[model samples]
Target: MPETGRREPGAPANVPAARPADDPRPSAPPELDYNGRRHRRAMDDATLWDMARRIPTALAQTARLAWSVDRRMTATILVCQVLSGLGTAVMLTAVSRALPHLTASDARTGLTQAWPALTVAVAAMATGSGMWILADWATRRLNPKIASAADLTLVDLHMKAELSAYDTEGFTDRSQAAEIGAMRAVDLADDAKTLTGGFVQLVSAATVLTSLHPLLLGVLVLSVLPRGLGGVIAARIDYRVHDRTISARNVRGMMRWWLTTSELADELRANTMRPYLQSWYRAMCDRVEGRELEGARPYLLVTLLAASLSGLFTLGMWVSLAALAVSGAMSTAIAGTAIVASQTAGRALNSIVRYGAVMFHHGLYLSDYHTFIGEVRSSATARGTTRAPAPRRIRLCGAGFTYPGRDEPALHPVTLTLERGEIVALVGENGAGKSTLIRMITGLTVPTAGSVRWDDTDLATADAESAWRHVGLVPQKNGHWPLRVRENITLGQPREHGDEGVWDAAGRVGMTEALERLPDGLDTLLARSVWGGHELSGGQWQRLACARAMYREPAVLVLDEPTSEMDARGEHLIFRELRAMARDRITVVVTHRLDNVRMADRVIVLDQGRVREQGTFDDLVATEGSLLGELYALAQDR
Candidate 1:
């Protein structure tokens, strides 16, 4: 197939563009410099202007990230912040108007006196203060709601992702990064509304101050520049620190999981590796700090120097205002207004600096997150609506598939078929595309070429869930749910965990003995953490999984070494039960155990993704000139 941008007739509508990892360019990094000196990257002035112009758009983009939770909360918070700012402006003017008249000797304005103005000024401050407090409160409350939304979204993404997506090695790294970043991004997005309000208030205050006296307004605005620049500079340093610290952070997060979780508890205690893990953790912490200090010290030093300069500049502006007041160039009221305006501007500047730093880091991770999300949504949407038919037999015509990171195709283009109501065995060594073929057969991965047809319907043309309804796969690893024994057995047939079906499924695999040992029989919890719960042996878990496939009763059952953990008696029992169940369904069992293979109605020998031979058990041995015959001789010797 050519690398055409368009989807084919049956391909998903939004088949994601498969980007090569080696692409030289990722997104452009921030312009802020590090190493105690500026290192200007190749960004044009127009680009700077464009990004500056996009600040409002970026703020709006930030707002959209939280809009799913409560649009009203975000709007209300911004409104409150703006209202406070507007009130501050009016109050400054009212008080500035009154102070000059207070010092005059019977030279009061005809409209009003100093006292009335002072009262209005106080009232305005009180109102503005209330609005500010309200905005802050709203911002804090939004965090959990936004975080919850993202958590649920991530869970859905992970669950909905097609099984084939995991074929790539990089998926693990990206998934870990996405999981941590998505949580962080949601948290930051929640506070974005407050930042928006604060910015609105800051601009509003500046506008009012400029009207008072453009000169004083300009000087006040300049007072915030150093800190704003300092913050951006500091953020770039943090980014550099992050690159060096990833290994340590990865180690720390891993250690925390191992020590705290039940998943690793058995291995940790059995191996007695606690001391080694603890030592590794201590080393990680030291390295984390060392990596940080390499770039952070210079950044901190520069930040302090710039902050000191900004503070001195602010003091000078105040002094200039006071001198002008003494000379009667400006009234006492206007002078007071200047002082208030300067304070407002200074706070506004601090906010920009603080938020700029946050946005920079957030933006970096967000870029990666957006890329992943784009692919997921595209894949989900592309699957479209699937509807498949129950075909009498499945056909594979030159079907091919390759794992994302693997060099060779997992399943080379080879055709095979299993007629209805037959037990077909797939015998091959590991990595011979047996499991991969099963996954493709189960509709977890679409073929890269050719097609899988169920009688008349093409399986690839249908969506995963719809196509999978007629198929059941018990993977090589026992995929047992940590729920009740009955629930685990009835996974594929939730509603039909009907009383009779549950009993039938349980009774078939000899799980009755295990069920009776539990406090509540079939309803007993399989995981230890649940109340009155009990654990099952490895063989017991495998039987329960088999019962699930039986309950579903899908037309096609692909059991990849389903009895790997079962003992001799259990294996014989399960195979006999399967033979009873296969009267009206096609059963494909992949196994290495020749004893089990003998029971299969037909054995298909696969070596390196190609069918080497196929025949009944006795017939293959009778040939006396193949891999099957050679294997049997070795088995008899053993």
Candidate 2:
């Protein structure tokens, strides 16, 4: 069945119809067709059409969010910003009107006219200065709003996206860049607002120019006509190209960021990977810039020539007005006014073109944000499906699976059922699908050829959130978050975790002693560069991971080699706590350490993707040549 109406390539020509949320099974009756052909309903024209229709609404929503987020401080700042724009507009008109008057006033019009023109210049400067002050104020007010809006988007991405999205290259890579790039939030909004204001100026300027002399206004409109069209055309093309390149740019950007900063730090130190990362980043920039240049170059070139032509036409219009003055058809003052009006009209058009270009091109990023939001709405999965009649039992029925981009199956036709409220240990050597099985059990991946069921309900249609909320996952290599140690331990929950809960969870995982030793107790920052911060060893962080999971007290606890980094004593303490908590919950432990393999009600030994043996720990060791016994002997290095 198609998910989210996306038409995936290499999918079956006939795809199964999507079942209703209530109906777990396909609705087709027997004898409907021999071919068993199904129509795949994925991303269709209707979806895109709907997007087009709602784009205005989306933009309005974003604008509102942007305003509200920063409005607290923005209100204070915007006054100055608006004043700056208004001041600039006034200064421009005043300067244009006075410049010609002063040039002509020297001999013919004399000192009488020169005095008024000089006064006009002073007034223009004063207004411009005032507007500049307002611009500063606006910047201060608007930046916070931009930051706030970006923060809101980030929060949604963190909470609304599935845990798997953080791992996937598409969602993670794009989302991270968007979040970081969003630091320009206020600037982006200001640019948008400036463009809007520019449009208003263009309208007012045109109206004023028309009043000055109708002939000059007509000439201005006709002369700059091509430039206006060219700008709109160029901007639209630039934006189109920009929209198409988002995923590509995002991938390359993330790869470069990772290589230069976080993931490949060790590798870069060892080799010349800095050069490589920089090279990749350079190539990505070229690709992004190349697309825009290629699309808009012609239009821009044409616009440049059109602007020059508009300037020539303005000169021609001024000459005609000068000729009229000489012929006594108009006064010298009227002729001077025509020249200013012509210049103002031309300048307004120039501003329009530039503003149009930026808005059209940069709006593509907004569309990326838009598309992401749309995808979120239809993210309903069978694994996240809920039911009224279903019981709460986790079952993996004939489950088989494979990771993305892998040829071979991770778990091949492997089936197992972990009954409710039973602690089971999944013992396996490296590459034995232990992690893969746990991921499937936890609804991270759908089974390739089987179904995971909660009670009698198919897990595909089961409420995955409810299933996961009751589930706790502790992985071996979970890293320490660069927050306070307490914050790291409390990420397992949704909200403001308490000091008591933090200590309680730490006590379960034997991290309370470490917390007590810190200067600020649980509040001490854990990252090295952060103020009053302290760092911990790998073993301690692993224990913290366990503590984080225990904080949740989930019904299904999955510990994937959770104690691999911890010492033998540390492992023993954690197991002891688990044994105490195993009374009414399902605790599934995935571990290679035979020492931590103690006391599960049953230990299922997996080998070659099959459960070779599952019984009490004693029974597994009793099997003379069993995998568990061999692993135990290897641990002792016997």
Candidate 3:
């Protein structure tokens, strides 16, 4: 059965006759299709309502923020704006008084009467300009302080937040968006000032217009409506584009970093990947730009229509004023003043609308910052008043942890004890919950189902910061700080550690020689982008990270795949030093290598988030059908 046989034979090409009512084909609503083509959905009612409500709230919030940042300066700026607005009213009144005299039939007589009014107008202009200068000075001082305060607030929140916050989905996106919010917090202040100035001007102009005639006040309101609506609508379009494209922006930013960063410079050149990277980057940029253009085109068309409407209404206002003058309902002086006042009023109204829109848009982003701060605070580890004691016998009583929004736990309930003066090795394949268990032991996170204790006290009752103080961790991908070698090695420790202490820690990881070879020794900067800065090889950087952990000299040490990037000699040196140091502290090493476990007092094997086996390395090797034996065999085969 050919597909066309189901349709009418006489039907025109690319067109279909009406289908039978019983046909199974699903059809889209014809109303949604414009000119037989589907169109994008308009802004929903909820979103439009949010915009309408947000403007006033955002403006008030921004004013409060600015006042908090600089109370004296904020008051001064507002006072000056009020005086300037009053001066504007006085100047308009003087112009009105002088106009009729200047246009009188007798020229000399007109000049005699108009001169004094003109003088007052000039004086008023001078006062307004002077007040504006003062206001500008205060604004300059206020904005930077607002930005600095907002920046520090965000950083402080991030510093206090727990590690679990970083692991959650959309956390990075929210954090990045929050950074933009911090910056916009400063702009919000500027918008606040502009709105204040515009409002005062509008009021002053309205007062003058009402004295001329009550109907002119109505004319002023009508003149601003079209442009005011257009401004708000445009701002909404921009915000919508920004909200929808956050993920795309993140991808584009990451691609740009990958293409230009010095970290990938070698790989890019070695593999000749520039062309492929460039093409990928171009594709991402095109997608982002396409979305922006799609929004922009429709907004431009709508705004153009709004602008035409505004222009027509403005023309109508002028024509009405001219009619009033010719019919003798108004004098030449009043008509002239009305013309000038109406333009000023329209400008003031437009400024209010535009500034309000900007503040509202920025507030939308600032809300992300506020939400992120609240979330981080809520997720922070519960701080205990009691300081943690030095670790002696750490025990996990059926401890387990499941990540947020997950059904299965990352680590299952398993009772275990780790004592001082012993070295332990955690061996497992990837995703076997090795790192999760390590974090639990260190008090980075509390177990979801059970308790972890240090001697007699539960870890949840111990101060997390104090507990962390007694622990040192060497992560798999350790940070390479763009700081002096001495600063990098002794990062968390007091700066009072002399050169000798640094040398001892570096020597244990075979980093002393590497540091000594540098032009400035321990003082040489580690960043490649700066002048006189040096870059280290991956293995060398790994060694430095190990030295940093050793310098901390904590009661509990956790090294997670610490030697994964190290060369054979470096790995051997670290293991030997760790074995020697294990006699004094509780040491736990997580690794896949069979060679490293041999040095441990005990080896723990994990399978599917459960402790599959536990024993001395030699005992594990002797057991048949053992998971450790299988993993050892696999490593050897590789």
Question: What are the models' TM-scores?
Answer: 0.83, 0.65, 0.86
In model 3, the Cα lDDT at residue 32 comes to 14
Model 3: runs farther than 4 Å from truth? 1-50, 106-112, 230-253, 266-308, 530-532
Using TM-score as the measure, which candidate wins? 3
For candidate 1, list the clashing residue pairs, or say none: none
Shift in Å, residue 595, candidate 2? 4.5
lDDT for predicted candidate 1 compared with the true structure: 0.71
lDDT of 1 at 438: 79
lDDT of 1 by residue, 485-524 (tens): 7778767666554668887887888877778778888777
- Candidate 3 lDDT, 1-638, residue by residue in tens: 11112346875553445656885443211111122211112232235466558777776766677788899988888899999999889988999999999999998999899999999988987897788789888888888888898899889888877777887877887887788889887666667778878888899989988987888888887777888788767766776676556556766787788788777999999998876566556655665787898898879977997899888888998898889889998888888888888788878877887787676566667777777888988977766767888789899999998887688999999899999988999999999999899999998888888999988878888778888888989988899899999999999898566989999999999988789999899999998776659989988998898899899988999999898888999999999999889877899999888888999999999988999999999999889988999888888898
| CA-lDDT, candidates in order | 0.71, 0.65, 0.82
Instruction: Assess candidate 1 and give its TM-score to the true structure.
Output: 0.83
Root-mean-square deviation of Cα positions for candidate 2 versus the true structure, in angstroms:
13.5
lDDT value, candidate 3, whole model: 0.82
- Per-residue lDDT of 538-604 in model 2, one digit per residue for the tens? 8898898888888887777889888877887898898988889876577889877676677788898
What lDDT score is found at residue 308 in candidate 3?
93
